[model samples]
Target: MSQSASDQSDRTSPVKTQSPLILDSLPDIPGVEDCSLRVQQKIDLILLAIEALELGGSEYMLATAKELELQSIVDNRVALWRMRCSNPWRRSHVRTRLTLKQGKALTLIASYRARQLTVLIRQLLVAQQQIQEKGLPLEQHFRLSDYLERFRAHFRSRMNPRRAKVAVYLADENQLNDLALSLLSQLLFCTGTYGLKRLWVSLFDGEVA
Candidate 1:
């Protein structure tokens, strides 16, 4: 094999042995580049939700990368920030396309973290359900309220308020909270079996023809 191919193999070897949750690679879907924008946005949001769920989330993300043996792609905090900034919605958006390999690494890290936080995620979801069933506001439950508040704060600080899409979310508290809840549900999905593969495919839903 070529040096690049051999190096790639060496990199993935650890992931296979590190955890059952780690995927060697995602399927080679056509037109992935065209869909990368959407993929980047979803990935960033997933991580953002995770950050909201826990204090010092960025640090956890870096540590998770090391724990998952995905540092070759994630590298460090600056690299992580650059990858996330690829999201066009960010205030410090960087014009870069997320490579398939980088996306897979992030998916693995996200699913693994989601699994670790499964109990808390379930509790939050249940609280959300109870709140909706009683027609009560989100803040009625303290933990859920805290998570939603953190999500909104992160969104406001990182997302560019000048953008039209972001302005709508900034103006409407309900709309933004709904997005946070939706992401919370997605995190729950990530904790399930084959969750990484499921999210991998879903990322290209519309772009793949």
Candidate 2:
């Protein structure tokens, strides 16, 4: 075999030995939501490197994040989150403090549900605009997610099937079984440029059909 082929054949990395994060913890990989396989692999590598720096502290963490260009993503939300969760700052939130259990729960939620939550927040922005246009007639009880559902139905009928399907696929990342697609049109209409970027990423995640 050739030198490259011989090296590839000899390599055998065990799954059990792989780490959860790349560095001391997770670096901001904002593009993971819409990344190519190569980009996704690099994200995994960043996580691993962060995991390895578990005891490296904030200075080292920020330094590494800067080195990796993590701040360039999402106005540095991930980098700022890491900084807030680090020493001195973690215990004193500008918003409020939480118990260890609450903190753990939130961390878990952010890890898996960040995209969902961001979409929800963006949806609320859309609902707010509608409310502004409608003038004063505030309901005593209202649910924005309901508005998202209704808006999707109206928007879907107005859109071509191909375009609508593409929007639905992008919104839910091809989760056909999930009702999240009902918010597709609203999501794109509200979240602006980042939402467009997220939609592009969805295509990479196999949303294109």
Candidate 3:
């Protein structure tokens, strides 16, 4: 059988095999325990975007957590759901707080997955760039189109549209697409050498003094 684009890209990429990411030795950020709501939302959204890109994303998160011995933080599927539901925009919003430990677990899982999907992420971003330079609609790129479509569907179904913030995205497709693209960019960043640390610190952007 012919290799798929993602497969071909992965084969051609220069990533070297490495050990799993372990956060046990790293000291927790000072303000991570007091993470703001926006930080929680951003972290969940980035994971959600990954779910949109890859099939069985939820399962993969669970598997990756166990592989990295982070199951203590991520635990079962319900635990993961509740963590993600901490996002204010979730239709099933729970007023729970995400601790620094839990946040780091999810961050590690996301970063690991991002590294695995680096080739595909780069391809999609490049496709978006080329399409825009040619003044072509995003749908002109099949893989990117599929990813954006899945992202929009996931967002519409999971988010509370009645919420003023989510309502704005519902009202404007372009804004939503831009958000999807932005998340794609962030995932690309997570594929970098210092991506894990960078993303972790970024979660505390404004919340930290």
TM-score of 2: 0.22
User: Taking the tens digit of each residue's C-alpha lDDT, what string does model 1 give over 67-175?
Assistant: 8766656768999999999898999999998877678878778888898899999999998998899999889999999999999999999999998989999999999
| lDDT for model 2 | 0.33
Could you tell me every candidate's TM-score relative to the true structure?
0.88, 0.22, 0.87
Tens digits of per-residue lDDT, candidate 2, 24-139, equal: 23222343332233333222222222222223223444454444333322124453454233222112223323222222222222222223334654545566568657783323
**lDDT measured at residue 71 in model 2 versus the true structure, 0 to 100:** 31
Q: By TM-score, how accurate is candidate 3? A: 0.87
lDDT of candidate model 3 versus the reference: 0.84
lDDT string for model 3 (30-99, tens) is 7456557898899999998999889999999899988887654566999899999999999999998886
Show pairs that collide, candidate 1: none
Question: Residue 133 lDDT in model 2?
Answer: 79
Worst 10 residues of 2 by lDDT: 14-23
Residue 10 lDDT in model 1? Answer: 51
